[model samples]
Target chain A: MESWRDNRFVFWLLSLPGTFWISLFFIVPLSVLWIYSFGEKTGITDVAITWTGQNYGRVIEPVYLQIMWKSLWVSAVSTLICLLLAYPIAFAICFAPDRWKPILLLITILPFWINLLIRTYALLAVFRTNGYVNKAIGWLWNGIDWLFGGQHPFQPLELLYNNGSVIAGLVYVYLPFMVLPLYATVERLDKSYLEASLDLGASQLRTLLSVTVPLTMPGIVSGVILVFIPSLGAFLTPALLGGANAIMIGNVIETQFKSANDWPFGAALSFVLIYATFGILALRWAITARSKGVEF
Target chain B: MAAVLWNRTPQGPLEYSRRLWLKLLLFATFFFLYSPIAVLIAFSFNTSKRNITWQGFTLNNYVVAWNNPDLLDAFTNSLIIAFCSTLVSTLIGGMVGLQLWRFRFPGKTAYEAFMALPIVIPEISMGVALMAFFIRIGWLTSDVGWPLNLGPIIVAHIAFSFPFVSIVVRSRMVGFNVQLEEASRDLGANQWQTFRYVLVPFMKPGLVAGALLAFTLSLDDFVITYFTSGPGSVTFPVKVYSLVRRGVTPDINAASTVLIAITVIATVLAMKLQAPTKAAKG
Candidate 1:
C-alpha cells in the first residue's frame, strides 16, 4: 500500500489545522506558565520577567512544603483505598454472566459522567449534621436507648469538613477510574492459569496473590496513575468538602490566582504538580521497561 | 485423586465464600456510587428552603430555577460553548488523527507526546496556564472589549477536548484496511470523492462518539471555564459552583438533576453507537 507520503499536499492539509490550534492554544499557554515560574512580580497587576528563582525558592518554604506533603499523603491514601475497593468489584463484574457485563460496566462509569460539583454537593447533603448519615445513626441510638430504658442522648458524628471527608470524596470520585482498567485486565485474564493453580492444590488466596495480582499489575499501575494525579491536584473536592484547615496544594494554587494575586508563585506551584506527574509517569515507564527486559 | 475430586464437584467451600465476598463487594460499591445521586434527586423536590429536612414534595424548585434569568442564561452559555467547541475540535482532531495514522513524519513521536500532555497533567495547571496566557496576551485585561468574551473559554475548551477526539479517532482506525481506499481509487473515483464516500462513512461512528464526548466534557467542565471566562460568560457549572459557595438550594438540585439527565442520555447514545464496533472486534 502506498504511504500517505505519496500525497504530501493532502497530508499537510490534514495536519495543519490541528497542529496550529494545539500549538497556539495549548502548547503556547503552558509555555507561558513555565516562563512565568521563573519571573517575579513587579506590581499589583504587573508580573515582569526579572528572571528570578524566588518563586521556586518559596516553594521549599515550610508553609508551602507542608501543604505539598499533605496533598501527597491525601492522594496516596485515596488511591490505595480506591484500589482495595475496586479490585473485588472488577472481579465480580468479570465473573458475572455474559449478558450482564455491559450493564455492570455502565453502572461503574455512570457516576463518572456526572458533574464533579454536583457529586460533592450531594456529599454535603449526606454528611451534614442534619444529613441522612447522622439521622440514621440517631435513630439507631434512640432504639438502643429505648430498649435499655436509658436516657443517653445521641450526638451527630462530624462526617463533613475534615481531612477524612476530603479523602472519602476523592475515593468516591475516582473509584470508577480504578475499576475500569482493572475490569479490562481481569476480563482478558486467562482462566486456565487459575484452574491449573487450583488443580495443583493451591489455595484460592494463594493463587490470587501469586498469579492474579502479578498478571493484573499493569492495570493496577494505570489505575493508580489515573486516580492519584487528579486527586493530588483536586481543588473542588477539598474546597467544598473539607474544612478551613484541609487546604491542599490545589487550593493554595487557586488562591494565588484569585484572591492572593501572586501569579508568579502560583505558576511555580503549578509546575511542582506538573513535575510530580512527570516523575510518576517516568517511574512507571522504567518499571515496565525493566520487566520487559527481564522477559526477553 | 485431584481429578476425582475435581470431577465430583467443581465448587469448593473456599470458592463459594470467595464468590459471596465478591458479590457483597459489588453490591456495596454500587450502593456507594448511586446513593448520593438518589438523595440529590430526591431533595430536588423537597419544599424545605434549607434542604436540611424533607418538607413534603413540590415542583416549586424546578419552577424557580426556570424563572431565574441568570441561571437560564448560564445554561444557554454552556450549551453554546459545548456546541461550538465540539464542532471545531472534532474537525481539527479528526484531521490530526488521520494524518498521524496514515503517514510517518519527523517529530511524530514528539507531537504525539505533546498532544497527550494536556490529558496527563493536572487540569488546575491547565486552567492557571491559560489564565496567565490570556492575561499576558492582553485579551483578558479589562480594556479589551472584542476578544474578552466567550472566545477564550471556547478556545481553552477546544484545546483540552480535541486530544480526546484524536485518541478516539486514532484508536478506531487501528487495523483498518487500506484496500478499500485503493479499490475506490481504481474505480476512477477522485481522491476527495473516495474520502467523502468511503472514508467518512467508515469513520462516522468514531466521529459521532468523539463529538459526543467532547460535548459532554465541555458542558461538565468547571475549572478551566472558571479561569478563562469573563464576567458576562458564566457557564452552568461555574454558576452552580458560586451558588454552592453561598449555600445549597433546591433550585440548584433541580438544575443538577437536569444536567445529570442530559449526560446520561448522551452517554447511552454514544455507547450504543460504539457497541457494534466492539462486538465486531471481539
Candidate 2:
C-alpha cells in the first residue's frame, strides 16, 4: 500500500519528460494552430495573418462541405469493409489451436514490416492493364474479342482511379488496425458462457449475437476509432490509388501547408481535424462506458 | 459418429470439415499477407525497361539499384538515422518509464495524456511544425554556420521515436512489482547498484523491443523526414518515392525487395529474443 504523497511524486516525475516534450512540440504547435484557425489568410504567395471567423464560415461553402462529405464517405466505406473482414478473422483466430494462434497473428503483422509504399505499389502489379488479373480475364474473353476484333471482352477493366479502387486501397491500408484490438479481445473471451448457451439449444447465429458479439463490443469500438480516424485523415491511398478526384481532408491540409499559401486556413482545417479526432476519442470513451453500463 | 468419416475409409464428414476448412483458411490468410511481397520479389527481376513485366528473368535491376551510389547512400543514411534514433529514444524512454514506475507524482494523468496525444494526432501536423520550427531556429538554416543536413533529420526522427519507446516501456514498468527495489535497498546496495543489478535486468527485454519498434518506424517514416530533412538526408523511403514518381523502375522493385527481406529478418530475430517474456505474458 502506497501513500498518496508517494504516488503523486512518482507520477509528477515520470510525467515531466513526456509533458515537457509534448508541451514544447505538440501542445504549443497545436495552440498555435488553434489561434491560427481564428486568424485570416490574407497574402498572395505568403499568408499574412489577420484574425477572423470567416474561415469557419467558408467551411459551409459547397466546395469545402463536399470535401468533408467525401472524406466521411471514404472513411465509412473503409470502416464497414474492415469490420466485415476482421470479425471472421478474429473469430477464426480465437478458435485456432493455441500452438498456431501466435504464428497466425505474426503473419498478419508481416505487412507492417514490409514497406507501406512497396505494399501499395504491389497493387500495381496485380491491377495493371497487362497484369495477371487482366491476362486471366482476357483468357476467358479471348474468343469473343478475337472474333469481333472491336475490343469488347476483357478491355482491361478500366476501373482504376475511381471510388472503388480508392475504397479498396483504404480497406487494404487500415485492415490491420481493425484486427489488432479485435484479436486482443477475442483471445481473452471466456468460452463457458458460449458453451452453456449452445448446450441450452441456442442457434449458432443467436449465440454469436447474444453472447459473443456484445461481449467484444469494446474491441469493435476501439477498432472503429483506430480505423476511422486514419481513414478520415488519409492522404496516401487517395493520392496514389484514387486520383485528383478523390481528395480528402488530409490532402487539403497538405496542399494548404505546401502550396496554397493559406497557413491560417490550413491551420484552421487541422484544428477541425484534431477536434474531430478528439471528439471521436471522447465519444468512444463515453460509448465504451455506456456499453459496460457505467453511469458516468 | 463423425470420427468414422475421417477414418481410413475417408468417409468422416466431421473430421474432414475441421481439418480441411481450417487448413484452407490458414493458407488463404498467409497468402493474403505475403503474396504482395512475393509479387514484388518476382517483378524485381523483370527485364523489360518499358512497362514492367517478366521478360524472362535477370538480376540486372538489383545490379543497377545496388550500383547506384545515390540510392545506396540513402540506404546507409536510413540505417544510421534509425540506429541513432533507437539509441536515444531508448535511453530517454527507459528513464521516463522508470520514473513513472518508481516515483508517484502529481499531474501524472496529465502526463499520460500528453504522451498519448502524439499517437492520436496526425503525423503531418508534426511534420509541418517541425519544418516551421527548423526554419525559425537558426541551427537548421543553410545560411547559419551549421549546414542543412542529417543533424536536423536525426533530431526529428528521434523526437517521435522517443514517445513510442516511453509508451511501450511505461506499460510494462507499471505492471512490474516494487518489491525487488525494496529488497535491494534492504540488502544495503546503493541506488545505482540496485538499478543496474535488479531493475535493468528485468527491463532489458522491454527496452530492446521498444527500441526495435522505434528503429523500424524511423526507417519507414517519410512525411516527417521529408519536411525536416535537407538535400543530404534522403532516406530509403523518400528515395523510393522519388524513384516511383519518375516512373518506377525494376531497380526500385529490387531495392524494395531487399528492404522487405531485411525488415522481416530483423523483426523475427527481435521476436525470438523477446519470446520468453511474451510467453510469460501469455
Candidate 3:
C-alpha cells in the first residue's frame, strides 16, 4: 500500500473542484443569506447591513406563525397519510412472490421518474372542476336522477384549489420516497426469525408489532424525514392545487424574493425555515438514540 | 400433521381476509400511483383546449407543440445545458468519488457531511441562496460589466448534479475490489493505462447511471433554474411552468408527454445497465 501521506496530495487535487463548486454555490451563499438576514432593506432593490434582528422578529409574528403552523400541519398530515398508505404496499412487496416482486416495486417507483411539475399538472387534470373525476361524478349523479325522476342535475364537487387537494398532491408526489426505503427494510428482514416466532405460537399480528415494527424503525424514520422535509418546503403543489388560503412558508419566501423584493426579510424567513428543519431532524435523532440507548 | 391442522384452523377466514386485504391494498396503491400519469397521457390527445372534456381525439397538440418556436428553443437550451452540466459534473464527481474511496484523510467525515448538505437542504433555500450569492458577488449586476448569463445556470446545475453523481459512484466504489487495480498495475500498466483498462470498465455501470440521473435532474429542475437562469436561459421545465400558470393547455400536456417519454426511456436504460451490478451485489 502507498503511504498515507503520499495519497494526501492526490486527495486534495481530486476533491478540489467539487469542493470549490459546492462552497461557492452552496456554502458562501448560505452564509451570505445568514448575513442578509441581519441587514435591513433600505430601498426597493438595496439592503443595508444594519445588524438588526427585526426580520427574525417579523417571522415570529402571529400571521407568520399561523402560516408556519399551517405548513407544519399540512406536512404532518400528508406524511402520516403517505406512511399509512405506503406501509401496506411495501409490506405486500416484501412478501410478494418472486415473479411479481420486481414488477410491483417497479410500478411503485416508476412514477418518480416523471417530472414533479408534470405530475402536479396531471393531478390538475383529474381534480379540475371540469376534469375527469367530476365528469364521472356528474354521470353517476345523472344516472341516479334519471332512475329516480329527479328534476335537476347534480353539480360537481369542489375538489381542486383546496387545502385537501394540496395535501393529496403532496402525498401523491411523496409516496414513492416513502415506499422504496420501507420496502428495502422489510425485504431484508430475517425470514427465519419471523418463522421462528410463528412456530413458537406467536400470532402474525404479535410478530408484526413486536418484531417487524421495531426492526423497520430506521426505514420508517428515513421515510418520514425524506417525505416530511420536502412536504414542509413544498411550493409548487400548494401553488397549483391550493386555493387563496393555502400559502405556506415556501410561498412566502418565494413571494418575498420574487415579488416583494425584500431580500433581507426573505433571507430571514429562509433562515427560520432552515433552522426548523435542522431542529426537527436533530430532535428525531436524539429521540431515536435515547430509545435505542445509543450515544448520538 | 396436528400442527398443520392447527395452523389451518386458527382463524382460517381471518388469514384469507388478510391476504385479500393485502392484495387489494397493493392494487389500490398502484392505481393511485399511475392514474395521474395515465390521465395526463390520455389528455394530451384530447382536442379540447380549455376543458378536460373529451372532444374527438386528435394529434394536433403534438403538432402544435412541435411547431411552437419558443417551446422548441427552451427544449434546445435544456438539452445543451443538461449535456454540458452532466459532462462537467460527472468528471468532477468521478474524481471526488475516487478520492473518497481511495484515500484516508483528516477531516474526511467533515468533508462528507458538507457534501451531503446540499442533498438534505430544501431546493428553494438553495435556489434563493445561490441567487443572492450571484447578485452579491456582482456576477449578475457588476458595475464593471455583467457576467451572469447561461454561465451561472450551468454552474448551479453542476453544483446540484455532481453531489448525486458522487454519491452513486462512491457507493459502487466502496464495494470495489482493490486487488484488481493492484494486479493491473503489477502487469506493467501505467497509471492512465490501469485506470483506463481496469477502473473504467469496473465503474461503467455506476458512471452511466450517474450520467443519466444527472441528465434527468438537470432537465426536470425548475426551482433552481427559475432563480438562476436569466432572460435568455429559460429551460423546458421553466417554460412548462409558465404555460401551466397561464392556463391548462393541451400543448403543455403534449410537452409533458414528450418529457415523460424521454425520462422513462432513460430510466429503463439505466435499470438495464444497473441490473448486473445489483446482481453482483446480491
DockQ metric for all predictions = 0.61, 0.42, 0.53
TM-score, cand. 1: 0.95
TM-scores for candidates 1 onward, in order:
0.95, 0.89, 0.93
Per-residue lDDT of model 2, residues B1-282, tens digit only: 654464465632222224545456556756755675677788888888754566878989899999999899889988888888788878877777776556545676776677667788877676766665665454345643222367777777777788788867776665567898899999999867987898888888889888888888888887778767766677888887777656756788888888888788878877876787766776
**Of the candidates numbered 2 and 3, which has the greater lDDT value?**
3
Q: Against the true structure, whose TM-score is highest?
A: 1
TM-score, model 1, chain B versus true chain B: 0.91
Per-candidate local distance difference test = 0.87, 0.74, 0.84
Relative to the true structure, candidate 3 reaches a TM of 0.93
Over the stretch B190-268, how does candidate 1's per-residue lDDT look in tens digits?
9999999988888889899999999999999999998888788889999999999888889999999999999989999
Tens digit of per-residue lDDT, candidate 3, span A1-296: 24448866676788899999899889998999899999999876588999999999999899999999999999999999999998888887877667878888888998888898889989887887777888889999999999999878989898987789989999999999999889888777777777777788899889888877887887788789889999998888998888576888999998998889999999998888888889878977876786672121
Q: What ranges in model 3 sit over 4 Å off?
A: A1-4, A143-152, A287-296, B1-18, B141-148
Off by over 4 Å in 2: A1-16, A42-46, A143-151, A293-296, B1-29, B138-148, B174-177
lDDT of 1 at B110: 89
Q: Using lDDT as the measure, which candidate wins?
A: 1
